[model samples]
Target chain A: MANGTVALEEKSFYEESTNKYSGILSWLLTTDHKRIGLLYLVTICAFFIVGVILGILMRLELIAPGPTIMEAQTYNTLFTLHGVIMIFLFIIPGLPAIFGNFFLPLQIGAKDVAFPRLNLLSWYIYVIGAILVLISLFLPGGPIDTGWTFYIPYSVRSTTNVSLAIFAAFVLGFSSILTGLNFITTVHRMRAPGMGWFRMPLFIWSIYSTAWIQIIATPVIGITILLVIMERAFGVGIFDPALGGDPILYQHLFWIYSHPAVYIMVLPAMGVVSEIIPTFARRTIFGYKAIAFSSLAIAFVGYLVWAHHMFTSGISDTARWIFSLLTFIVALPSGVKVFNWVATMYKGSIDPKPPFLWVMSFIVLFSIGGLTGLVLGSLATDIHLHDTYFVVAHFHYVMFGGTGTIFFGALFYWFPKMFGKMYSIKWANISVALFFIAFNMLYFPKFIMGYMGMPRRYFDYLPEFTNLQVISTVGSWLMGITMIIIFANLIYSVKKGKKSPENPWGGVTLEWHTASPPPLENFHEIPTVTHEPYDFSQLEEMKHESK
Target chain B: MNEDKQNKENHEHITPYSTYVLVWLALIALTSITVTVSGIDFGMVALAIAMLIAAVKSSLVINIFMHIKFDEPIFKVFLMVSLFTLVIIFVLTFFDLVNR
Candidate 1:
């Protein structure tokens, strides 16, 4: 390490890099990515708990037939809180902020993220957004129930805290944009010497693509939400139908960002799975370049297909047809990734570790989700499914089944690396299995109920749908219990589980080359990466041939 | 090694603040022209002109202030793909709007 002095200077530059902060002051003022990531991890876990409780309450009210828990407005607020917390707080930051922050610099063989201070700032902004939304709940008019999308006319006219909710959204979008900007710059400028563009890991590529989506698409939604806030606060008539403005225009603007926002949420999870599968499969990913390129393709095409959500929002037949076609086209890249994962698993030495099990389940559930997406992409079909439980089922299939599975899978994959501890494989498997079954039972019935013409957001439904709703409620409770078990297992591991090896899973990536939980600066000497990422064969060859 | 190379590339760079100013003035001029032209009765043509002017202004801002003009070619590709996708959304929605 002749350039050890350069490394030393860099280390002193980030003097507090490796050490765990002690006092409240250290925790508050730290700019370390690992600390910031831990901050997000704790915050989002709290939000997820809140959201799940809201979800449980919503389900309980629908358990019998009528208002069992609270009034209709209360129910509306409950679902709205559930939607806002789950989306903006829990899922959007699911992989990127938690795992990406923890691993991106290490994976790229760098000291820290491109802009570590900006990373800390993004977390603060996210917290501020949550506070804003929470404060809105206590305002003179109750919390907003415009269904997260906050479509105007309804949102503008309602006396609820529309301004606060939209402002919170504006702040959240900024947080997302800063993260994207950071990742994009980091990938571009901070890679090791020999790591070429295509040589980077698929997870990095996926986040890179997602970052672009965050940068470009987020601003549009920021402006859209700003206009909504203005309309609500100052009597501006941008999307107010009574003021010669088109409410539909607000829908148009909102979907422009919100549609791509879902892509932002899922793309990083897909990246995480791409990393998990090949490592566990003991094979180079089939069609690695295609999978990497497809990430960008998906993000690119994701932007074009926003109007598919609005097909029933009354644009026009021609627009609907065009959107339908574009939506189907967007499905191809995702399909490519799925096919490649399956192909990688074929005839390979697959390790059925818990992470791999979750990745396998992600492939299955994500397929169902992606296929159902095609159904909604169809104009004629969407006309029937829009705002129904079918739409709800589709989103859950993707977010819960697709991204949710990956979130857990990433936790398992990176847990040892992040905390220097190994979770119980037996319990992890049991809980994932329980979750998988409950998840399908819960959402699968929604598809049937929705196609049978049951609308979503209903406090009371037809008596015939009562059986399915009860079944869904049972499944929801089961999933909630499974989540509790999984969390307990992880917490138990952190406290008493065996200390993990630096490269416990035999992962060949740069991340495993560092100490468990990583050094504060992540690396001692900046690695001059000279091989393709995920080249497990090279590592295999380097090991002794004999036992 | 690439960092050193990049450092070399950037060191010779004259500050582009003048370029930024020039582009900003051009954007302002084009927007004013578009606002003035909107007063004429050209039906949908006015909308077309306004959007065109907007497109030009946005390109200038993206190119100069955003540093896309001096960025790596890969970033330009990413930007172009995003812009192309935005066009797809706008065109498809317009089709829906027209059909309505």
Candidate 2:
């Protein structure tokens, strides 16, 4: 129970590693989890920026309807790259790869992940996969215009570098698998003595559930993408209708993995929300077991509902009904999580920090996303909304509004701990406000346009869709400015901000027990756990100590 | 070092070498039986038989070769959950195709 002990003599993780290699090589070749997490951080941020730019370009093209900024082919490629970079590189790996890698072991009172070298290898594989994607962009036939899904027949027939891009995704899938393996092993074997499964932080539970999906569901995408690459390269005839392969079969295979991949992206974000809520509310989490078990329940039910994405793909009525039923079922667990979070904050001394604000926005935005998902999950309504901008809006509400907001919140929550400096809270809150407003403005119109039958992935829209499109584009510009402000505030704070103490927000987790910007090995002496995670008495004790 | 020793003690389970041999033989026997059954025109039943044999073989590999039998109950539970998920996916997907 060594909570809030100072190890002033110990060097921070940034200062050195056990490895003899110094400077950049220490980062590049090190097996340290914190360093590797930072590696993932820098890499995903670069990709996220690239994705945002591609997205803005697509929005610009759509702003005025016909051929505003780029030609039809360029627009197609831009959207394709935008989806690939965002889904595969940024959002899929966003929270888990960065924050989970850095914080999981720290929170569990372990020195590093179970397979530290394997952790480093996953980052390397991630870079290699990312490089392959970039290389495909400049290849002979031009970047793949096949959307990130790489739906069959078109993917088979496209002369572009679909094979390379698909292969890039395949490599990325392997990286995902290894990371999942590392996390699962770490969680199973690396918890501190006396830290039973229930005693562990809810964040660990969410990450564990996500890891299960990653290992079990990701291989389906790996094999599916390889089949596409094979079909493109050698006419394997697996998905090509002309070649006796069923296109719907391809849809089945893709969603089998891709749908679960959605949970992979959002489940960890939900875990972040759980962590932030209890800390800010200054109370033990409400329904801790319910929230923890709901994560697994989501992962379980999530796998069964991938076919909901195929409702318009001419799937059987039985399949559609069953999947639609499962889709609604999946929503129950998510609803449980949301309700539990709200209950946790009930009548508590809520610290209205930037991170908590983001969590509040997450509850609103993700609820909108989740509720509209029910709209799309219903077979009757999905037929009308399939492939429309409504679908696009629903997705962004969930992915960007839900996961993206939480990612920023987690960064805000942990920034002081990770960097030993506090960012400007005023600027942080201002950026979050602008971001939330601009985000809704940007994507909310899509719900209207989509319901009005505005088809997505189209280069031109009828004049009726013009005004809403314009509003969305203006929102994108605001988003761009917001991004600039947010990143600049964080970047500037790293070098010049006030130094953070060991427990900045009075967090009760094991991570708060150690130094901010913890040592390379994460702890001076591995702590033995005695209390349940989010136990408020620890926070009360720390507060008294400060006085 | 003490933690490492404790972890090793927790996870290291040594199965009898003869058990692996027996599981390997069973897997091979199952595979050959499946191959021989494919010659008969039992139609859909033949496919079911083949799958049944494959399932048994996999369980043997998982439980014995993978040491889930001797290792931890949690490992076996997760293994079952993973397989159950695969089954649900297949059954649900076919529900659409068959009904349509």
Candidate 3:
């Protein structure tokens, strides 16, 4: 406990990491990874709120058989904006930018990322891209109505602000690529001594794998978006079908980046679950190598399954079947991870805290998402269900249920470490309960509606679909309420919550070895790792020593 | 621990200027071969030959210019993995094109 007192004497990264600036300027200009993480945290939350409001509006507009609030064109623009903001601005960069930036160094026992300056520049580029998206919304031609995918000929021929929006996506891809490059370099060059590959935390493993996908796959989308912009602006004949370009080729390039980009979103969430489950279970992970290798497996296999998205898009039967097989194969690694997580929790000394509840929710929701993914991955069913609400329900269950829930779970899990304060466990649980119930209510109906042959992206629904649309709209309100409660609780807790201990969760990672909120240099002295990550004996020893 | 220290040590192997010139010449020669072979279009085989020559040229540039050959094995491993990913995308796309 003497080191705890000494750590208290050490200035936290929040207090002052640099003397050149003060207050807002200090945070704005800071190269400190933790501060930059806070910067991302604030920015993404703002974008998330915008996305949520847009989503709620879309749901409200769909509340009846006819248009409820807006015209079809307005509805189209709203969904496009909602999709663009949510996918590109919020979820894609959500975990890796916020938590990865803050904790990758701390978890690996390093002073800072290998390229701190590039890390800051990536954030700036993200903001610039966001600004361009904002500018596109208000230009002479309202917002883009081409959907977030900006699919071909329609995208090239659209009169809306498609050019700027695609360009925004291109710039955002650069931000993603740079962050991925930085993490890859940091992991490769900067692990603490004795922290062998296997000894590193599973969170590090997941982020490393996600980073590789970000680096390799993002460039394809970047170029694809650029080509779309060119086709729009300069009349380039690349992806425009009218100009003798193949529209399916655009789908190929788009999904090539985007399908793996799904892994980019969810893999880090998996990483978060990996960290949370072991900590809550108070045990070594059931199969460390299996879980770690599965991340690599998922990443490797994820790249091969992009064309599964195009099964019903007039792609050849051979490509369709091959991609369908690869899609199912990719699920095997995810299955491995899911099984390993369940096994890790079996017969262990379980602590069902707020974070653990979220992990449990993630397991259920992501399982539904992953299992239903097979139905859509199959060539026959996809032809039946493509562009239906079934596909919508599937991804929302996976992306929102898997990644979005874990994003909050990680926020709760790492709250104390990041902010040096403890949020109310009661409020946290209430929020999770509302979220779980409301989330299922919101998206589960889509599966049924989709099976009943209700098409997605429709401004108006048939009278038969009216009841489910109303239910889904009601669910959106509950989701909005849940968001309000969660954000208000955390923001209030930041100033008024109880002061947390250095290691609140009995977490055995190197991040827990540092001060809550961590110092400017992270470690007082870099601790040499002799035990494997998730070693419970060391955690117990540290607990006893602290006591 | 010793291996850790050894990995940390900056083993900067500087390539000679002559090596860069020779690699550049080889790249130019490969480019000319691709261009010349394109003129003589051996049906479908021409595309295959051009791609093969382009791959070899890129490997040389990556190995010597990017220092993949002089660097640790892990770099080469990652490079191969990335190339393999590209191969997967191309093969899958071609599956559709060829079949259709």
Instruction: Give me the runs in candidate 2 sitting further than 4 Å from their true place.
Output: A1-4, A543-547, B1-40
lDDT values for all models: 0.83, 0.90, 0.91
lDDT order of candidates, top first: 3, 2, 1
Clashes of 2: 1
**Which digits, one per residue and each the tens of the lDDT, describe model 2 over residues A1-547?**
3453556777899997859999999899999999999999999999999999998888888888678878999988998999999999999988989999999999899999999999999999999999999999997999999888898878888899998998999999988999999999999989988789999899899999999999999999988988887887788787777778889999999999999999999999999999999999998999999999999999888888888888878888778778889899999999999999999999889999999999999999999999999999988899899999999999999999999999999999999999999999999999999999999999999999999999999999999988999999999999999999989999999989999887888788888877779998888778878788988887666555434
Per-residue lDDT tens digits for candidate 2, residues B57-89, read 888887777778787678778788888888888
TM-score (chain A only) for the predictions, listed in order:
0.95, 0.98, 0.98
State the TM-score for model 1. 0.92
Docking class of 3: high
lDDT (C-alpha) at residue A123 in model 3? 96
lDDT of 1: 0.83
Residue-level lDDT for B46 in candidate 1: 78
Q: Count the backbone clashes (under 3 Å) in each candidate.
A: 5, 1, 0
Q: Can you rank all candidates by TM-score, best first?
A: 3, 2, 1
Error of 1 at A329 (Å): 1.6
Query: Ten residues in a row with the worst lDDT in model 1 chain A?
Result: A1-10
In the range A1-547, model 1's lDDT, one tens digit per residue, is 0111122132321235433665665656677777777788888888988998899889889898878878899888788889988998899887888878878887888888889889989999999999999999999988988787777678877889888887998898889899989988899889877778888889999989888888988889888888887887786787876788787888888888888889988999999988998888888889999999999899888888888878777777777777789899999999899889889888778889999989988988888988999999987788888899999999999998999899899999998988888989999999989989999878999999999999999888889999999999999899899989999999999999998865677677778766666667777777677667877865553232111
Which segments of model 3 are wrong by more than 4 Å? Answer: A1-6, A544-547, B1-9, B16-42
DockQ of model 2 vs. true complex: 0.77
